[model samples]
Target chain A: MSKIIEIKKLRKVYGDGVELVALDDVDLTIEEGEVLSIVGPSGSGKSTLLNMIGLLDTPSNGEIWLKGQNISKASSKERARLRNKELGFIFQYHHLLPEFSAVENVMMPLLIAGVEKKEARHRAITLLEEVGLGDQLNNKPNQLSGGQNQRVAVARALAGHPSIVIGDEPTGNLDSKSSDMIYELLRKLNREMNQTFILVTHDMDMAEKTDRILRLVDGKIVCEMLRDGDKFVTRDLCKLDK
Target chain B: MLELFVAMKHIRTRKRQTVLAVGAVGLAVAIIIVFRSLMNGSFETFFDIFFELAPHVLVLPKEGEEYIYLYKTLIEFIWAIPGVAAVSPALSTTATLSFEDNVENVDMTGVVPAELNKVTSIGDKYMIEGDLYAIQSGRRVALGDKMIEKLEVQMGEDVVASFPDANTMNLVVAGVFRTGVEEWDQAAFVSLETAQEFLGDGDVITYINIQIEDPYQADEVAAEISALGYDAESWRTMFPQFEESLAFETFSNNLILVLVLLIASFGIANVMNMLVLEKTREVGMLMAMGTNQSQIRRIFLIESGILGLAGGIFGTAFGYLVSAYFNSLQYTVNAPTAPQPIVIKFLVDPFDLIAFSLLALILSMIAGVYPAHKASKLDPVVALRG
Candidate 1:
């Protein structure tokens, strides 16, 4: 119902002598409590867009507003603070610290935000149980299966109770069954907690499960699809010329 | 606190690397401690032998004067100085002693037995045969034990002594002493009256020996006495070579310690760098979780500091054990110039040990800085992509 994030004229260019444009003049908006996905080919800048929203990378040119605050040019420390307090991220590889157990991995963001250890641990356990990882609390990432590790990563992302959760191909490394399970879990969490989620993926089936889908090609959104009664219907052709 | 927890976990999980790094640092510290203790022990033993054999300060006659004519007043004046423990005036000359079959050159000194006993340890510590006080009553001599062997004479035997342009005298050997030091053992002592008669000088002495409460305060005490227009010298000034050698030994020992510690610190740096490289992805995840660059740097520093502390403790314990073992053995060492061998007991000062441990910690921290900085500066996106 309300705009949670807005990006205008976003651009990311890499290299010194010969520049390669990763994202070009991208304009997008995310609504609160919405489950949405960005679907595109492999080199279409979907992950780059996810990284920008997650505050994991600096943009060369952009105006990004998160809950009415402009954070496009925030200092690195401030960016980290915003990322910890307002955003949660799940990467394709799970990216859990190998030295920590599942519960500890879930508790990291809470601890980083200066939460007490006991409280963080309790909340992390609750989140892990919610993600059906109750029995794997003390298991390290290497000791767990691909699906179970992704579940642990999901629990970790939700541990901070962030306003927005961002996933960059979170299920890309898992099998189809594990991928569907992850999608179901994300859908359930979005409904129960009323938290917004933005996923980047190439799986058309996974994209169809979200409330809305944005199709990207050559760093530009060409169309958007809205879910209507168990199916997605294209709203309009919003293609940008090169 | 979380940073520390993470650091500790990192160290714990890498068992082999941690042990190797810690072992390198520990071995370096142990080597430093052992060598430092041995050098300190040897110096202590050397100074003990030197101070016992010589006076803290000696007052000689003015230039061109053969003897101190006003020796009595000079002795009284030296005795009045603060920290002066005892003062004795003595006359000494090189003379030859001849028995029936053997003859040898000896340094002859004359002293008042009571005063000499107070200024030197000869009467109390070195006497092996008849009493030095026996010389006070008659024209008797206390000869060194080695001289007794060389001259083929026994205690209570009469020997003929002669000096340049002085009448030869017949003296009976009354006491035998052994100091374990060649220079002191080959000397002889007699009554002051006998020396005055033999040297044909009336109530005069060659030098006044002054013992002090602290041997290290010799320079200050000697300076005060020298200000009174006498040729005064401390034992340190008299033996410049010994001082130089002691200084050189300390310098070389410390140089070795620095080099070893530097090498050990490089090993720490190398290990830490490898850890940083290996944990690049985890570092990116931490950054994504809101850990600042400074916090990232602190995590690595704390890890290295813990390693250094662990190593220092282990090394100090190992060094103490080894030193104690050697000290218990009471190994004998031969000083090149001395005729006797000394029993060496390793002594490690507690303050020196603490300082060396702290030095190890500081050096390891310095070595960790580069790697920590590199870890902190990593790009989260690129690192995560790895």
Candidate 2:
């Protein structure tokens, strides 16, 4: 498979006097049409990594290549364009604008991509229907349930038909049943659209269900798990220190 | 268009704040309008009094002479000038009038009643008791109301007049007139022929008062008339103090207007700043959604513009209504040149209304700049966390 994204020796440091490293010497690659999970404990830089890959933040020292284009030195405006046209993001909380309805929220990303209003609206309606929110097209975020709002957000993330979707704990705020539903929906969309998805999660069961899992501990990738037919195999590179 | 829509939505959601801001602008605009209108009306009143009581151009004799010779030829020559509507020849001198035991010194003026009527509206408009033309037939005199009261004389009563030329005569009072000006009321009037005969200044007159077609062209006409070897004084030259007062009034009015608009702008700025602070998170979300900084600033500017427009329209209408009510009420004001209390009336100029409204709109738009800049400069990362 062709590599969709590549990171080389990425380092993200916070604070001035006493530096705190969020991501240190991290190197990773994501292939096209791949379903992967990034599992980490709290403060393990899962969100920092997602933000870096999503073009939401700039790295202190690193080169990130998205579809063979180096974006680490890109201007903010160019980065924003790339984010709007080539990538999508879903947060733990549904960040849907309270003033806009579900369909309108779904239409936001397409609008940001400069799509005509009529066409954007049509595409947003189709996406909302696909997410089982066809009956709640006019409902605002506050009027909808938490799971429904999350589903609307998911529809919004895919509205621009991006090549890769980055989810920072997409189901973390939902109940167990809603989390399962969201995961299943994501998996189904991944298989149907043949699009790459990188999800960050702490749920072991959810991590086990993905095609591949990268375990991050203290800003370093310690293990990689891959599914082989009905069985899963794990490789732990950091275990040699024990 | 989207910016406008979003701005309108925000304003609608914050109804109380919007109303307060709009009301502040409205009240400021209304006060400015009222103040300017009243000042304009008062100045107009002062000018009207000056114009009605004095001729636009007064042709006087040379500096050393008391009266102009060949006055008839001079009158005909002045009448031939373009823009000269009418010219009335008059003679004035100081005299002492005695009726019973009351005695007072008064400035006596002699005029041709018919010619004077053409030069000034005073004869026709201000005659209270007797006919102004009655002075033409008999050796009769018209005593001003104040003069009559001081002399304690009745109509048709005979009074002794002692002139500066050692001429004394008993003249019958034909009329009592009041011009609402204390100085003018203290003067007495008689036939021009009578004054020339009694004062021993025959075929001569002190001055020829000239009215013009356009009062504003008085200075030019006065200059043209002065070419005839006589000193011509325009009303503006006669009363430059009034013009100075008008200038000061305008300056004061403009200062107040600027201060009022400044206060109103501060009100708008305060509201906009509060709104930006409240919507910090929303601003971040919009930026994250690919809204440019310029677009965000434009939204806030449009919001302030709408508020200004609304306030301007409402305030202008309210000001007009208030001024109209003031015009309906009758009040008396004392003026230095007026003998009686002058009626006060408020007048609104359309130019002032339009200018003030535009000023309010511009001030409000200016007030939006700082807050809008603050909103546009918000960091998406920090704002989203907010």
Candidate 3:
């Protein structure tokens, strides 16, 4: 498969006085239709790396080639356009607009992209149904349960049919059953639609279900594991560095 | 379009705050309307009453000269100028009137009765009894009712009139009238020929009274007349204090208008700021969904602008209703300078109401700018964390 994203030496520094390094010389690549996860302990920079690839934050230094465009230093406006057209994001919390109903929340990305309201609503209905929320179309975020809200958020993320979806602990706040349901739903979308997904999670069980996993520590990827049928092959980048 | 939709929802959901804001603007507009209505009503009533009988411009004898010789030519010259509706050349002199056991001092004016009728409302509006035209007959005069009272004389009676160093004349009082003005009610009117005879002066008049189509144009007409070497004065020049007071009132009105609008705009700003603070996470989510900074700003700006427009409309309607209610009262006040009590009416110009509403809308939009900018400049990462 052709590479959909390529990152070369990404670095993000935080604070003017303390200068904490959030992401340090991180390099990675993902192929089209790949389902991958980044897992680590607290303060491991998994969210920061997701934000960089999601175009929500600028890196201190990096060359990011997304679908053949070098967007590392892209202007904020251009980045925002790319975010709308090429990427989708699911946070740990639902992050659905409290003012909008389920269908309306799902229709937001399409609306932001200037889609016609009628067509956007139609597409949002199909996506919500795909996420098993067909009957909750008119319910607001407060009216839905935690898992249902996150499913609605997933429907919103997939509304624009973006090339890549990024999830920062997409099921972190859910119970085990709800988390498994969400993971299966995301996997089903990835396999059925051939869409790429990159998730950040603390749950090893969820991360192990992905096709590949990158383990991070102290702002660096220290290990990687690749799924092989029912097993996984591990690689230790820390030892390879020496 | 999305910004507008979101803005409408935001305002709709905050019903209490919106009502308070709209009520503030409404009260301000209502206060201004009531104040302006009463103020303009007073000025209008004063103009209607005073200009009813007074000349717009009066041409008196030139300095160092007692009378205008060949006044007929001057009268014709004044009538040809644009806006000059009527002109009456008259001679006025102090005279002593004696009628059997009563004697009184009277100011007597000589005129062509028809011309005097055209210049002032005395003949139609103020006359209480008898016809002014009766003075057209020789040796006949119209005496004020008050003067008639002082002389203990009635119409068809004879009164002896004498001026200092001039011949005494016995005139038949053919008419009696009252004008409600103390000075005019103590006066008498006779034919020009009789006045010339009584003064023993040949073909000369002391002053000319002019009525113009527009009283406000009096100054220009007076200027034109003064250029001909006569002493001319417009009513405005004769009453500088009135203009000064009106100017002061206008200044205070503008000041109050600005202050009231400023106070109302502050309310708008406060509501918008609170909205921005409360919607921080929502703003971040919008940004993450690829809504640009400018679009974020537009949402908040449109929200406040909607509030402003709503407030403006509310205020305009409220102001109109209050002014109309005040007008229905039909109050009256005594005017010490005027002959009778004046009725007060509230008058509002439709155009003024529209302009004030638009001004409120514009100011409210301005008030939205700061908060909208602050919302736009928010860091998406930090905001999303909240």
Which pairs in model 3 have colliding backbones?
none
lDDT of 2 by residue, B1-386 (tens): 55875788778878998898889998888888888778878877776677777888889997788788878887777777788888889998888899999999989888998878877676787788888899997688998899999999989999998866746888899988888778878989989988877788677889889888877788998888688778999988997887788898799879978899789878889999998898887776666666667878998998887888777877888898898888888677876755567878789999978887888789899999999999988876677667
**Highest DockQ model number:** 1
RMSD versus native structure for model 2? 4.5
Model 2 interface RMSD over true interface Cα atoms: 2.3
Candidate 3, residues B1-386, lDDT tens digits: the string is 67886788777767888887777776777777777777778778767776766778999988899999979889889988999888988998888989998888888999988778877767766666678898888998898878988888988989999867878989999888776777888899999888988899788999999988888899999999899899999989988777788789888987988798889888989988988998998898888899998998899888877777777777777777887888888777886655456778788878768877877778888889999999998888888998
Q: lDDT tens string, model 1, A95-209?
A: 9999999999999999899999999999999999999989989999999999999999999999999989999998999999999999999999998999999999878889888
Considering every candidate listed, which one attains the maximal lDDT? 1
Tell me the tens digit of each residue's lDDT in model 1 across B60-166: 98888988888777777777878888888898977799999798999999898877887777788789999988998768999999899999999878999998876
lDDT of 3 by residue, A1-242 (tens): 99999999999999999999989999999999999999888898999999999999899998899999999989988988999999888999889988789999999999899998899999999999999999999999999999999999999999999989999999999999999999999999998989999999999999999999998887888888888999988865643341
- DockQ (C-alpha based) per candidate is 0.72, 0.32, 0.67
Q: Model 2: which docking level applies?
A: acceptable
Please identify model 3 stretches exceeding 4 Å from their true place: A132-136, A236-242, B49-54, B59-94, B101-105, B110-157, B164-182, B190-215, B219-233, B336-338
Clashing pairs in 2: B180-B339, B181-B339, B182-B339
- Span of ten consecutive residues with least summed lDDT in model 3 chain B: B334-343
Docking class of 3: medium
Clashes of 2: 3
